[model samples]
Target: MSEGTAISDASASRAASSSAPLAERYAEAMIPVFGTPQRVLVRGEGCRVWDDAGRAYLDLLGGIAVNALGHGHPALVDALAKQAPQLAHVSNFFATEPQIELAETLLSLAGAPQGSGVFFANSGTEANEAAFKLARRHGGAERPRILALENSFHGRTMGALALTSKAAYREPFAPLPGGVEFIPSGDTAALEAALAPRDVAAVVAEPIQGEAGVRPLDPAYLRALREATRDTGTLLILDEVQTGIGRTGSWFAHQGVEGVVPDAMTLAKGLGGGFPIGAMIAFGPEVRGLLTAGQHGTTFGGNPLGAAVALAVLGTIREDGLLEHVRTLGESFAARVLALGDPRITEVRGAGLLRGIGLAEPIAPQVAAAALEAGFIVNAPDPSTIRIAPPLVITDQELGSFADALPALLDAAAPAAAGAAAPVDPSAAPAADDKDPS
Candidate 1:
């Protein structure tokens, strides 16, 4: 059959056996925030997944960096299976051992100072919600503003949305919490000016803006924010939701970058390896007492199932030395892709497994579609930026497969859609960096 005929047949077959009825059910039952489903992923394993149609894909996006251990790792599976049969959940009124253990583990990894406290939530958005509330508790009547960076993404919840810098995400939900100001990321002058107001509660930033396509803030800028916030009695909140858990080849992206320490930090995404969990870890004694017993809580936060799964993911990352693995694999993967020397690839930027390939032309969406047809899964954050945050456990062989396929993917995305073309100016007009400040 002809290529066009085959394509039409596949479309018709998909429509005939469609999940559109379920989609219609969702349309009526759910809010139209995310729009139509992209793909109905049925099952996943380490570094790979299949759609409802059973099309195999090399999962390079890692569920947007949430599946740190990939899908269905033995350790995570065992933890969940064992914990579910034993005790799945309990009320927040009663403490659970897994919750406490996970809390201690997160606090320890964060390296918070003594008397630090932690609050658990179910998603990155909720983690930021707790952080926002904690910041407010610290600010009280004196300071109420939060200084965030432009081009930042911090989830869609009301408080987190308020802190996010994008007008498109925040404007639709108007009258959000006030006293928030936006500044250009890495712009020392703007950050200083914004935080200089004694009425500011905190300056929240992601060490590397993940949803904005893995843009890392300069070490010097982070250090400066720490000092600037300190001078004005404001708090420094680092939203490590996407950059944490070995995503940036570090236990935490902020570590070893600069001699800077945030007063509080929020983590999620890769934290649970797939299971949903999020945490807010407050450092030192500054905000420890800010929240009393009756201040805040979550019913499903830190449930035994999630906590147990997270514990296993953390242990596996340590025991398997996934951090060093991510560091090495990331460097090699990046080098190979950059060496592709594709004209459309103007620049490549990332840390560890989370990287973004910037295209000279607006063709990332097409490139991603091409990649899917090629049996790989990748994501396009913008028309010009292809974001890759593969599982930290992705093997070298898998990385090579992607590297081998990349030149073809780029060719398929470029003008002729085949064979290598002459390299374009690497210094071509580049897309502006997407910064996340929450």
Candidate 2:
């Protein structure tokens, strides 16, 4: 039998055994924000996972770039186990040592001084909220307008949502915070014109646009932003929520760029190494003091439990030299992918562990489904963009396995574009294998 036939058979079996019942349970209990749960994953370990049915998968998506150290890393598990037993919950009325230390460590990594401060939150959106508040408060009357890029994604909260450029996402939640303007990313002239009035509070951008299919900004454009913001005293906010913590093979994506020290930056996702935590790092005092004692607070933002987990994650990244690992592994991974010599791939773009494979056709969803059937986990940002943000600690051997499986995945996902028409939607398209994992 053909390989496609094998994949279809496997899909059929999984559907018949447990996938159907689990999907039905999800339909009854969960909101459809993310559609049905693609797989009922039950447990995971170092770049791999097992679904509820005991099938294993190489998790290349890394929990959407949240599992920097990968799932069930000893550091994170031990930290959580130790901290949870000692002190898990504490209100924001008091401060914690771990929080303060984590803040200082993050600042140091960002090339900021000792006096730099951080505001902790539970997720990237909340961290962005803190950064937004500080930016607006510091802008005063000079410029309250924030210039964002089109096709950029910050987060989903009301405040962050306003800065998000996707219409479908923003249309449902109207009346977002005012004074946010959209501009074409990497267009220096357009950015200058948008900020020329000096009425813009800050220019917010993702060093690498994660949600928009791993699009990266031009270095020259970033330098121009630095100069323009300085000329008009506008703040530059880099939302590194998905790009930071070694996912980019660097501490921060803007680190090597000249003359671009952002006033405020938001980080989350991989910061806690799979634990729930977020942070807003403010630099240069322009907007650090904008939030007063009671101006902003989160009840469980920097509690002992989260701080402990964050510290462990950071410590491991440093001690294990994951930055170097990401740099080396990412280069090899990208090179291997490029060598696939597949015509369907339009382009590949990324910094380090976080990358996107742009397909010539709108078959990303299909590609992802096919990959899942092959015991690999990946995500499609849009119909043509396949996002590949694996764990920062992912090994070359694991990536090699994925490299071998990828051609088959792309062929199955976009057979029509490759001269064969698919019989159904890619997401629901039946695979050929009925028993094989890969």
Candidate 1 lDDT score at position 146: 80
In order, candidate lDDTs are: 0.83, 0.83
Candidate 1 residue lDDT tens string, 271-344: 99988999988898768787788889999999999999999999999999999999999899888888877776
TM-score to native of every candidate shown: 0.88, 0.90
What is the per-residue lDDT of model 2 for residues 1-438, given as tens digits with 9 covering 90 to 100? Answer: 999999999877666765456767677657788877888887887888878777777888998999989989999999999988888987887777887788878888888854568889999999988888887887777777888899989889999999999999999889899889899998888988887776888888998998898988888988888889888988888999998888888888887577778878899999988888999988865467678888898987888898999889889999999999998888888888889888887777988888898888898888887778777888999889889899988888887777766777776766745667544323322222223242
- How high a TM-score does candidate 2 get? 0.90
Clashing pairs in 1: 151-435, 152-436
- Output the TM-score of candidate 1: 0.88
Tally clashing residue pairs in candidate 2. Answer: 15
After best superposition, candidate 1 residue 270: deviation in angstroms? Answer: 0.9
